[model samples]
Target: MGENELAEQFGVTRAGIRAALIDLEAQGLVERIRNRGSRVRVVTVEEAVAITECRMVLEGLCAAKAAVAASDEQLAELTALGRAMTKAVADGEPVTYSDLNRELHARIREFSGRRTAVELLERLNAQLVRHRFQLALRPGRPQRSLKEHLAVIETIEARDPQAAETAVRAHLGSVIEALRG
Candidate 1:
């Protein structure tokens, strides 16, 4: 679909869509061709691997801080979101999974009480999502993602700070491995 259609569909102005598309294009998530206009980028395997590496570091910090700062209510909410993420992946809804993944990470950063880290992570997430979406759409990746999400949630719930960080690291590492293979 064209940018105009997309903007109209979302009830946004063409300029808004144009600006967003331009930003995404700069982040390598969209490709603006001479005449063809913009298309969602098809992530290369190497780019996907790189995205995983970046996520490993940011997500690890978020999880570690969550272990220290997450209240019982926040933890419970995280658990619920974890379950929702798992279900979204299991259902093989890549778009839904993408949205849920962003929410899960954002919530973790927010709960961690690290405003600067949260802002940085949010910016990183935009770039990472572009490549991660490619990996998520691969065959059988969704189920594997669900398993990894559950592991991270379990570790965080236990309040084992180091373990939580390790779990997130392992999960993102596995994603890198999967993308490489």
Candidate 2:
């Protein structure tokens, strides 16, 4: 659908749809055609692998550091985020689960207490967002993700940096396998 039709379908104005489309295009979610209008971009498998690989390294490091460095409040926040993910998964709310899952990982990165690492991770994160698989929310996967994340959190809570890192690496490895299959 064109901008006007999309706006009408969603009960919004044409201008609102136009602006949203422009924003999504800027974010690489929509590809603008010279004459054929915009289309949703499909993320290829290779792109997904690359994004997951980068995230595995950066976020693994974050989990390790956060285990060693995060303050009590920070840990609490992370735990709360994990619980939110768990609830979403249990409820089979894919959209909420995916969002909370991302937030959980981002929170770990944020609480790592390393400015350089956080900045680098955030930059990588923006690029990876475009490649995120909606299938991550497939009924069983979110619950599995919650369990893996809880393992990471347990290590973090114990201040076992190496264990936390290993947990994240293993979790991400599973994700890679899932993506391949």
Candidate 3:
């Protein structure tokens, strides 16, 4: 976008937009062409795969930690969230299911009791938003994802760290496969 457009959108001056664009360019999150203006960088297939793989490992660890650390209240909340997601699936509301899906994962990270991991995961998740939305748009994927989430929640509630880890990895592995396709 043009510097003026970004400035107007963010309520900043053109100079401020330029500075921010320069920073984003340096971070490889945008490309600044002399005449063409800045644009969000497109994620490569390889980058998407790498991000999914990293998420699999990190989220698996989070599930294992959550299995050990989650309290009864937290587990109850997860159960409620799972039920809501189920209803969303049955009602054929992909958008609602997607929102609940994000919340469910965030709660799992919160229950993991690892502040640093949660923060890192948030950053990683921000990078995956576009790809995740694409995956969610796939036909019948939401129901399958809901089942995987239920499995992960069940393993966590059962207090089986190893099983929770395995379940999370499997869930994210399916995501990786979807991304590959």
- Strongest candidate by TM-score: 3
Clashing pairs in 3: none
- What's the lDDT for residue 117 in model 2? 75
Number of the predicted model whose lDDT against the real structure is largest: 3
Sorted by TM-score, highest first, which candidate order results? Answer: 3, 2, 1
In candidate 1, clashing pairs total 0
Candidate 2 regions with alpha-carbon error over 4 angstroms: 1-42, 130-133
Query: Against the correct fold, how does model 2 do in TM-score?
Result: 0.74
Task: Give the lDDT ranking, best first.
Answer: 3, 2, 1
What is the C-alpha local distance difference test score of candidate 1? 0.79
Error of 3 at 70 (Å): 1.2
TM per model? 0.72, 0.74, 0.91
| Native RMSD of candidate 1 (Å) | 4.0
Query: By lDDT, is 1 or 3 better?
Result: 3
Cα error, residue 136 of model 3, in Å, equals 1.2
Estimate, for each residue in 1-181, the C-alpha lDDT of model 2 and write its tens digit.
8977898899999989889989988776678898888898766767777777887888888899999889999889878988888887777787887887788887888788777877876765565564454557454787777789899988999999899989998998878777776
* Candidate 3 per-residue lDDT over residues 1-181, each given as its tens digit: 5888878998999999989889877765778777889888888777988988988889999999999999999999999999999999999998889999999999999999988888878877877788888888889999899999999999999999999999999999999888888
Q: After superposition, how far is residue 110 of candidate 2 from its true place, in Å?
A: 0.8
Encode model 1's per-residue lDDT on 95-157: one tens digit a residue: 787677767777777877877777766666665655677777788877887778778778888
